[model samples]
Target: MLATPVVFIFGRRFFISAFRQLRHGKAGMDTLVALSTGVAYFYSVAVMLLPTFWAKKGLPGHLYFESAAVVIAFILLGKLLEMRAKGRTAADIKKLMGAQPATATVLVNDQPQIIAVRDIQVGDQLLVKPGEAIAVDGAILSGRPLINESMVTGEAIPSQKESGDSVYAGTINENTAFTMRADKVGRNTVMASIIRLVREAQGSKAPIEQLVDKIAARFVAGVLCIALLTFFIWWAFGGPAELSRGIIAVVTVLVIACPCALGLATPAALMVGIGRGATMGILIKDAAHLQKLAGVTDIVLDKTGTLTLGKPVVQEGLWLDDDRDINAGYPKSAARLLAAIERSSQHPLAEAITSYAISVYGKDYSKNNDIDFDHNANAASYINSVFLPGLGVEATLGNDVYYVGNARLMAEKNIVVNAGSEKDVSPEKPVDFLTPMRHDLTAITSFLQAHTTHTIVYFAQKSAKDNRGTLLSVMALADILKPDALLTLQRLGHQGIGLHMLTGDNEAAAALVASQTGINRYLAGQLPADKLAYIKTLQTQGKSVAMIGDGINDSAALAQADISIAMSKGSHVAMDVAGMTIVGDQLSKIADGILLSRLTGKTIRENLFWAFFYNLIGIPIAAGILYPFTGFMLNPMIAGAAMALSSICVLAASLRLRYRKLK
Candidate 1:
């Protein structure tokens, strides 16, 4: 009776919460705890106060006040341990938050002023000193800094940054000081987006957890019914001390059955797995998407931006007929015209051509040229410039039309490409007029095409009489492969995943990348629709497809795939449509993410199994099933300890995922 007051006071929360849940026609873990301890406490009080009343019924008046107190103490201790373990699961979020400094040095009116990070505004020029964290996302205006991007990229090597390069928040300026124009401040920074994504992913419930919740909802009520049935069986069948045995059985059954473990099985594993992924620069947007990543069978990769570096550079340029009268001042005039036409388009190849022209003919080539071409002074000199999606660009310059694109685009406009000595050579047909020039162009075209894997671009001028343009020059451009492309593909292939490459590039370039990467199957000349259709076809074959891309054309295909991955350096449209984003634009993270998903899935299954198995064996023994043979009956205090240990076991299983290697 002395221990009753202390037990009631310390465990009041359980009783109060159980009462509230009962009022709403629901029950939970609190309900079972309250019923067991409440029954034991009140029954002991009855025995202590009414000794004579129990003597008449041939029963000993024993007080169980100590048992009730010890049970509450054991449960509280278990809860404290579980809380500490759960805190460790979110340590990654804390580490990421710690990466941001509280204050930043801003260049206010040509002088450095220290200010709070939250006070930073867009377009503000912030100065970052050596060995300091960047204030926010911005582009470098001056000074090249070697930045340590491991906070965002998970790489140890510092990246070399120059003028016009972007720097993100939380990155360390390892080498030199630089001034930057802040483009994204506060919540608009990339680190802020990564934090938001990681939080959402950790908080989300997997599909399996939804099923567990439904089972756990009815679990408490079912355990209550079983406890009541155990009481009746003991009261009727117990040979001696039936009342004592019956009350003991009721307390033990209610205390030993644990619903907490069942509730925590899936969510605990998901939290630890997602938190670990963030540390490796893998931002998982949702738990459901991470679950889907494990079962991906075939992975469709985009040629540019995903596997190869998206930047294309000019390698070689050749003039078709240098000795012809019409080709006088050929190279210079052609370079200026090509620059003017390509400057109007937004394609990467167009940018490469424009840069090449500016480098060869100087930025202000019109000042020294005799031709009437000045792109800056007379912007309308190149008029009606149209960008054909899969073809090239078409523009008109001073009554002479020009075509700059693939061979197919040239053929569509009836332009004659006189390459090689054969009659039906290559995709473009040769004209019979310039025989000697054709032989020279043929040798050059054959050498360029056969020697290098670079993409070929043709420059042609239209004729007024035949309406067929003459091929003026050919330029070869190349997009280099990523450093980790081959290794990443090899790892994914070893894991039994089928790899396929899709691109809008021509057959020669596509074949070369495929062969170099050891990919067996590839398709070239694939437009946006063609890529989308390929993904759908793979899905129709009962194959789970994962698409990795980094362009606006890849948006539809990214959305259509079962699992879509995007490079952080890619276009916004592709990233917005993708389910997962690989930071640092590293292809190897794709394999790491898949391996993490498999580990998380395995952990969740083990947790669920242990939860169900514990309850199946524990509840019966607590109800005096063993007393019929060896005379063993579980004490209420021991039952409480066992229940607490079950939840701890589940948490420990989940925490194991944090330490597992993701290679």
Candidate 2:
């Protein structure tokens, strides 16, 4: 129970915030106020009886009434502020529900109508106007336009989308009109999921939270026992004059050690850590991941997709032979011819080779395609490039124009080569290595075994009929590591965090990427399920693993990991699965996240120590440690002041997090 005078002093703020909260349907706040007032009044009437008891026992009225009022007032006021702060933050569930849009324009019989967001159901059609927010997750049945998904996905740039493109709520349609088929409404959308996860994470108190309760419960019980003992020793066993002093001692100990500070220890630290992590582009997701991440020792990398640029580029090409059938096998001359045709195209592989041409030959050789490749009617265009859907473009130097694309492009051009044939030059083997890759190639080894080219040479050819044939010889096409990637990997290693790679490409490519990224150990040839299985295997063996990914394919692994981190530039599915998302592509943020979590952990321990030790040791001293000889009895006010001091210590420690300056 709180003291009476303190209730009268600040009764206004409590009743106001409480009443306002109650009007908004926050019963907890109302109930808490009622409980506080009820408990306060009960204690008030008890303390009022104190002066009567003293008078009846032949003591002065002035000493008994005045001291009781002052001591109780101070402790109660401190508790009031703490309760207010807790109520504000503990509205986690409300915050989660707040992320949804309150209303949406629904399509009724093809006419737009407004309705409460909650009333909209799945399968409802919603008309999305230009320059407005998408109110729900839906697919566009019509119109093609670009979108800005920055608020939801952190992708600031506008990306174009056509009919059949899925748009998420909270994503702004930059310059297009889309009629949406609502797949998810209100709190069930992706944005709603993020809000829900954040809420759950926040409400989830750490072990420290329960520990504080344990300490407070135990300390409160023990203090009451000792106060009872103190009353018995002085009043029942001593002279009549001792009863007044015993009454003062018993109340003093109870008032001085309320356990307010102990209850706050874990929460104070948790708030600091959570706040710090949010600013650093890392969300710890839960107390368990926050604490466990600080101690991770091994990082496994998914090779092809994680480290080196997942995109493939033309490395080297050479003219091996003209009669050699440029399409028949891999040749230095064919590599260069493929490089030139790619220069004519604007596709990724085309740009890769075009860039290669500029780098090696100092000329941007892109061909202005007069027509977009549509179907077999553009079979002439098919002769020049092969499209690897998830990967990049590959070029085939053929009897026709230079072909660029996946293995399919080479086959479409009718350019088949026997892998057994050998060629001259730098790397693998077989001029026939230039053949179309088999669709059945599931593993990286299977793909490499099919390629027989040694030195990839780059060259430009005039046309298929040219006596010199389509062959441009120069340096090989390749991908290089970003200069900072290696340093990030190495530094993360120093912090005892493992770096792993993930990719959907071949193993040789995977190894090359891993080598560049400085990851010493790697696993390749994994489909999404394979990666998930690996995560489960490691977890079963008792490993604390964190999976970092930025694609839909990584969703399963992200879900199964002890900690899931998504790239801010990643797909929506990946972001949904991860515990935290980096606002930028930098992986160094992971290391920084762990540092902040550990700092919060330290603060929690410190606050608990002070809260625990204050009650553990202070109550005995406050009960008149030297009462017999020196007669140094502790007053109720001093005990109340000590209780306040413990709370202040916790608050001061937590405040330091605001200035922690994590780089």
Candidate 3:
């Protein structure tokens, strides 16, 4: 009688939930446990309260109070262990949330004031001292510092941040104090976005999870039917003691067939897998994306930032006049004109030229007294400058008109190379500079072909008489390829993944990076819409495509891909459209994410197989299927223990994923 209260106390929740499910005309795993234990406990109560009632049947009047109470105790213990294990799966998200600081140092009236992070508003000047976490996303205003972005991007190396550079929240400053005007505060920060994504991913279910849920719902009703059939069949065919034997078999079947393991099979593995991905800096946005990642057969990569540093630097420049050697310096008059035109353009090549000119020549022509000019300040005098998309910039300085762009721009303006009559050069002689312009263009072209990776920017001028343009100079620039690019491509290639490069650059530059990085297929001069079309084409071919990019141009394609992966350094729109974000901008992590997904898929399969196998085998044995062969029946207490063990085993198998090694 004392033990009966123990069962009611520990098993109260289960019985209440089972009653609710029964009222709604639905059955769950709790229903089986509640019914089996309730029947045993009430039957034992009847014997204890009225011994003469059971004595009439000659049923031995055995009290089963201990059996029912012990079964509920064991099941409750298993549930507690499972809950603890599930709690460990989300520890990574907790660690990520802990990285953000609660307070910030805001500059007010030129004095430092400590305030809560949530109180910070846009345009507030914040101070970030060395080793302190950045309070919000902002642009640096004063001191230069090395920031450790590993918390956000997963790359451990410290990145140098100076004036005008953007910094994110939750990142730490390394060696200098800096003040920044806050640009994004509160939930607008990247850290907040990552947290939201991780939580949603953990809660969302995959397609397989839906299938498992459907089976679990039906599984309970099916188990009850089998138990009823087993009892009836045995009562109709067995000997005089069949009444008691049939009742034991019915209770055993209900006790041993557990749907808890079936329901836990998919969710447990997904939780561990997503949490593990977070620790590695791979933010999976949804459980369905994890499934899609494993099926990716083709990958499209953006050229500029994805494969290279995206910062181009001038390598060399060629002067058109033979009398003026480029090493000596470009002719003062033309250098000023070229510099003024390039400074007006925002293209990467133009920026490289402007930077190179400022570095090689002084800021002012008269300040140094060497007659070399700094045309950056003189750019205001040139009026009506027009930017031609994809071509170059056109501008006028005094009586001369200048053009700075690729060779295609020169061709579009009808500027002819090698058209001048005079070629021989002398400082004293008036040699036609236009004729030597063709020589420089040819030399730059040959150099670019030999290098295969340099971007050439051409300079041209219109003749006083002809009005059509003549080539003046060519500047070659190149961006640095990432150190891990080649190895990442090689590994992906070895895994039988088809790699293709999509870029807005010309063929030569694109080919060079592709070849150097071991990517065999490529598409050059692709616009944003074109890239999106290409992704759709690949999908039509029955290939699941993963598009990796980090710019505004890649946003459309990223949204169109089955699996979209964005680099950490990429634009906001790209990250917003992508299904997964590679936090460190490490190309190698792409392969790691894919490999982890495959492993997670395997784990889910193993869990489901074990869950289904346990139920199928246990249900039959509990129904007394082995009684005739072994002359023995399964005990209700042993059946309850077996049911609890099955759920514990599934949880243990899924927990193994937290320790699996990733690439």
Candidate 4:
């Protein structure tokens, strides 16, 4: 009688939840637990209270108060262990949240004022001291600092930041203090986005989980039906102690069949896998994408900002009348003209040329004091300046028109590139300076075009008399490859994954990157639509393609691919469309993400197999199927222990994913 109050107080949750589920016309695992324990408790109570009534019917009148209490105790212990293990699965997310500082030093009226991180608003100037974590995402306004981004990017090296460079929240300032204007605050920060993505991914269910749900929904009801059948079969056929044997068989069947293991199989694995990924700087958006990553057969990569560093620099430049001498006066003059035209454009190549010109030639290259050749002054001299997308820029400089762009842009302007020949040159102009340098210019252009794989830009001058342009100089620009790009591609290639490159750059530039990275198939000069169409074509051939890109042009292809991966350093548009975001802009994380998915998938399968196999083999023995053959019957206490062990086994299998190395 003392144990009855303890059982009701501690075990009332199961009975109440089971009742709520039955009212909604559904039966779950709680229903089975409630019915089994309730039967044992009430039956034991009846026997203890009416000993004379039971003796009259010839029943043993055994009190099962200890059995009821023991079963509930084992189940509660199992639930407590499972909850603790589940909490560990989200440890990475908690670490990320902890990385965020609680307070920020904001600049109020040009004075440092410490305020709550939540109270920070956009455009607030915040001061970060050395060793302090960044409060929010923003651009540096004054100081240069070495920021440790390992918390966000998983890179051990601290990144050097300068004015106009972007800084994300959760990164620590390793060196001197810096003041920055906040652009993204609170939930809009990158750290918040990563945390949100990880939480959503862990909570979301995979496709295989849907099937498991359907099975678990009816599992309790089926177990109840089997338990009823076991009781009837055992009671009708037993030659001695029929009632006692029937009650034991029914309790064993109900206790041994566990639905909790089946329900936890997939989610447990997914939670640990995604949390592991987050720690490694691979943010998976959902469980479906995480599962899909394991089956990717092909990976498409973008050249700029993906395989390469995306920072284009001027590699070499050749002036028409200068004999391979960049320091010559004419070469400097030509570079100045190129900078004057390119400084107004925002293209990466254009910026490279402008910076090269300023660095090679002093900020003020012109020697004559009479001519004002400053950037702002030179920019104002050109009239009718227009930027042509996918080509270059055209501007009217005095009486002559100058074109600074790719070869295609030169072709559109009717500029004839005379290699070693002066066919399009005006007859009236001086040919004395061009005669000796014509062969040198041709050799230089040919060498640059044939030997070097750098992106070439043509600078030409359109004559007012002939209405045709003459090529003046050729500039070669190159985007450096990432340190791990080659090794990452090699690893993926060894795994039998087909590698393909798609870029809007020229064929020469594309060929260089492809050769360096060992990519056999590549398509150059591809626009955003072309990239999208290519992904579709590959999908039609029954290939699962993962598109990895880091630009606005790649947004369409990223959205269209089977799986989209974006670099953290890339544009927000690309990351927004990507299924996975690789922090630190590391190419090797792609392989890590895929490997983690495969391991997680394997773990989920193993867990599901164990859950199903345990119930399939345990329920039968509990139902007394082996009684006629082996003369063995499963005990109710042993069945309860087995049920608790099944859930623990499933959780242990899933937790193994946390320790397994992704590589």
Candidate 5:
């Protein structure tokens, strides 16, 4: 609706200034656009000096550019909203750091007084109350409590802690009060380190950013050269009535032919995707990872951190002596002997050992001569009479001295570990045993296939009183599966994806977790080289695999996968190899990332089609499409309108990507 070339010139000037400042300025995109808009507003006046202006209307005449004005306004407004939306993601990380109390209750001069977190010096004593954020990273000097370490693990389900246990800043004190010696203060805290990571990650550009810059440099020069040729050709072949023909064609080409939209497409989508992901509890390290993840078909998962809660739980326990029915030549009392060590154990694995015993034997365990250990004491519970002088818990029930702990415990006393019953299961040693319920992970694979758990070692030794000794039940335990493991596996399965579990955990636990989550392929008790080899095998078979891990041992495999996804809670080595990082450790977000990347790729193609089509079709016609027909020359005003509209269409096409529907 604007007045002729006046409206068109204004739009042309707008694109020129925006393109120029963005190309040359040492400012941000928002600042560049602002400065360019100002420069173009004045530059449009230059259009008046040409013959198109001198013959009729004066130099002050408007360019009459309605569409360009609309597009520029719309793009600027879209950019502002996008920036604000992304800013919320950064605020979340900062807000987490902000939650640490402004003031801390410190023991200064032996008196409790509130002071700033910065003022608390090292070696300062702090009394943490029940349900308080730990002011400083320190070791607990005294007391025991169930601390909720949701700050670190993101799992707030009350984990117990005692004296000598190390605690960090920002963890809520869930149980009794404790005295802690401040070891780290101020910037040395865990919270401080995480804040620093977020800052470093936010400011970093992806490898693709440099590629975009190179492409733009070549593209801009080429576009300008083509525009120059188009103008000269028209003047030579078709002839111009006035010198203004050169000016109109030159301005139209300069304003309309820009590669800015293409340059911004990938980065804009990346910025939005990563920022949006972080808000939903995921963090991608770079934009290239989005491109990488789109191609991944299979995912390799680590057993403990990725699939299970990583806590050892009690599943079942069997004592040989308690059973009334005999199995083969074994005694009916085999079940009771297993409970002897299981009952004395406090380990998470021991819970399963005793749990199995209680289910069969019933809960009537009473120690007539018991060692009364209280919540106040850091003590190992025992029924004193059953233990021998050196060998662990020696019960005379069947008159056998059964030992538990490690091979070192057995070697220390020079007790001969029975080879037939020993299951030596380390990736380094890899010993096999014939004993039932051996903790040695050597049989984790077979046990996993049968859906049994690892974490318990079973053995019995000869006693002088009972020289005709028997192999008694020594131990049984459980390792809890990772949290939300089943859900994660199910989500992957729903997408028709296959998952492989690569782990150093014993086969029994690894297989059990895999089965529980419906994972059919599990490689347990694997070395780092083994994991890497497996990844290579998948690669050789043309599988696009994604490896997810959270440990130093997983570095090689993580790097070997097509896309390496690192958990935010994982070790440094794992994070280093990972192409993408999940900031808040939500596995489900990975699925969302894949969907967004494909949609964005389709959008760029569609936009480029519109951009290329407008220029390719219109410029030839404006040059002289029907010179042999009616002999009516193409109007400079119409050419100007078509050129301006070309830029408008490209801008509109690119902006339409914002409305892409994501699954």
Candidate 6:
């Protein structure tokens, strides 16, 4: 028939591949189709050529060429659909690989020259012009520009980078040209690492898949044995008509017991689930993590960048000397001096002070003689500027030395603040002229206590002739929480997931953020080791822990948790180690991801159950076991169509995951 050529054209590869597998003694799902269809087609040709011989045995002498062709056609159709779905599942890796630039412009003998990205090496100086993607991870040698790192960090806002700050490949340089010294290239780049992670994850077999593979391996052999047994039973136990019935029973068992549905049970569901997560802005690094996410019982969140906006702003300030009212901003001259010192530092706290100072007093005080503030342009005039790590800034402003830091820095410098006309000063430092009257100490304490949740930065000054400094003023800075943080936490709690906040911030600030976000428990002032230890303890208690954070300090904890989540705007190290990255930095996506995981898991279990359940009941019926009681037998042609229907049903069940509501 004309249909034979069409079937052969599409199904030739399946037959050849299956034959090769059988000859090598490694039978797969293809082998079952090849054996059943090959027998049916060739036997039908024999019956058409020699009808007298089949008539002698009282056989039907009917040709079943169409049955064989239809089976191959149905199978080929299923394969085409499965292949398309598999490609969509791995599209996330393609999106990530596309981000890397193909070429880079490097400085050759101080002149810009274009070269392939692979040709660029470490220590090479590259130029990233405005709107151009960075070619490699490097440090800026010169030029200050705003770089859009959303490609890597998932943060929508462009971050400003000055000279000596680090820039990564795939990030766009905005509105400026910058020269950078490449530190990593090619496979060593962060983008390359992300691509590799996604590929490995997609290729990795989930734990359930391993179980299915084990069952499938033995399934084909069992089907062959059942078909042989069905043939022998019909010939040995039945009357003269059993000869033709025996032949039909053999083909029926093999056709009906096709392992296609069983083999596709896990992978089909996994492909759809992983692909859906990518589209929803949740990048699942691997299928293993997808399986792990649904089981997470406890979620640990970092405070700084995860719950609250990382940007700190000045809330309030008060001068130690009552010369200016506390409700008003710092003294104009002191604010100018503080801004100048802060402008020289790159700390977030320092940036807050500088912004506050510029708003309270103009950027340049000389523009208006009415105010005694100094210009920020003279910020570089200070000498011996040292940025004490985790403390504050120390710089010289004219003939006097100034210190802008926290209470701990003031104590370390031995700056006395007590209730006396002449405070008890350290003998090693000159502090005879300074005094902390009872009223002034009471006022400072009251103001600081009132803003217990704010980060208070002290501004102190001393004459160059003296080693000690007098406390001039204090500024309170606070980082506000994200708008959706409260609702996201409440949703997670309602789902029975325990919420715990782990932060490096002080207890008071952490407590305020926790209360506002509706999180009932937290561990403040926790280091990376402390977080890792807590996750380990939770795991020991049979709780699956998920840690969400966005800094280098969080990388270790992320690696330790059952599921690690990172914000889009968080540190590269944290995202790299995390199993899931929320592209929009929304906490609600975590809940959505968990919901999708549970739904996908349920679908896979249903697929697997139907696959096994169908074979368990279908195989015996096809073998003619019901013929003795009901006199009903599964025809070879009907068995082929039923087998194809089972596979289509499995595919349809898996596709349902694609439409499940994430919200």
CA-lDDT, candidates in order:
0.73, 0.56, 0.72, 0.74, 0.55, 0.74
| Preferred candidate (lDDT higher): 2 or 5 | 2
TM-score of each: 0.54, 0.57, 0.57, 0.57, 0.53, 0.63
Predicted candidate 1 versus true structure: per-residue lDDT over 497-548, tens digit per residue: 9999988666877888898899988998775567778988999999989999
lDDT digits (tens) for residues 1-663 of candidate 2: 433455555454555655775687643322333333433344446556676776677644332232333334433544543343232223433433444467778889988899887788899988777677788888888876566654343222244566788888766765546688989876677666655444443344534336544654455456657878988888776767788777767766665565556656666666667667777777544555565566565555443223434344655443334345646554433333444456555443455655654454443334434322222223324455543332234444334444343343333433333222323321233223233333212322343344333112223333444322222233344444544567768778888776666554446755766655667666665655566677777778777788877655565566667676777665655665566676666667777877776787777788878877887677777677677779688766566567667777888888798788664
TM-score of 6: 0.63
**Candidate 3 — what's its lDDT?**
0.72
Q: Candidate 5's error at 404, in angstroms?
A: 25
* Predicted candidate 3 versus true structure: per-residue lDDT over 483-568, tens digit per residue: 78888888888988999999877787788887788788898877566777898899899999999988655766776787888888
Per-residue C-alpha lDDT of model 4 across residues 130-205, encoded as one tens digit per residue: 8899999999998877776644443333556789899989888875788999999988887786566545434534
Tell how far residue 539 is off in model 2, in angstroms.
4.0
Give lDDT tens digits, candidate 6, residues 1-663. 754674467667768878798788887667777777777777777888999988988666767677677777666654654454322334444556667888889898999999999999999999888789998888999987777764454333356687899888878886668799999998877667655544543444445446655675688778888988888889889865686788878877877786667656666777778788889999876565676788889999988879988778788876764345656654666777666677667454677888887776556543323334344345444445676644677887567677888787787775544312344544554443224545667777788888888778887876666566677777888987877888888889998999999887768878899888878889786755677788878989999899898865566677678788998888765776677889888888888999998988888789889988888998999899999999898877777778777878888998998888765
Query: Which scores better on lDDT, 1 or 5?
Result: 1
Candidates 1 and 5 compared by TM-score, better number: 1
Flag the better candidate by lDDT, 2 or 3. 3
TM-score of 5: 0.53
Could you tell me how far off, in angstroms, the CA of residue 356 lies in candidate 3 after the best superposition?
Answer: 5.8
Q: How much does each candidate deviate from the true structure in C-alpha RMSD?
A: 14.9, 11.2, 12.7, 13.3, 11.9, 9.3
Off by over 4 Å in 4: 1-206, 210-225, 238-248, 319-348, 355-439, 451-455, 458-473, 478-480, 502-516, 523-542, 551-562, 571-577, 624-641
Clashing pairs in 6: 153-568
What's the CA error at residue 499 for candidate 3, in Å? 2.4
Give per-residue lDDT, candidate 4, residue 146: 75
Checking candidate 4 for backbone clashes, the offending pairs are: none
Candidate 1 global TM-score: 0.54
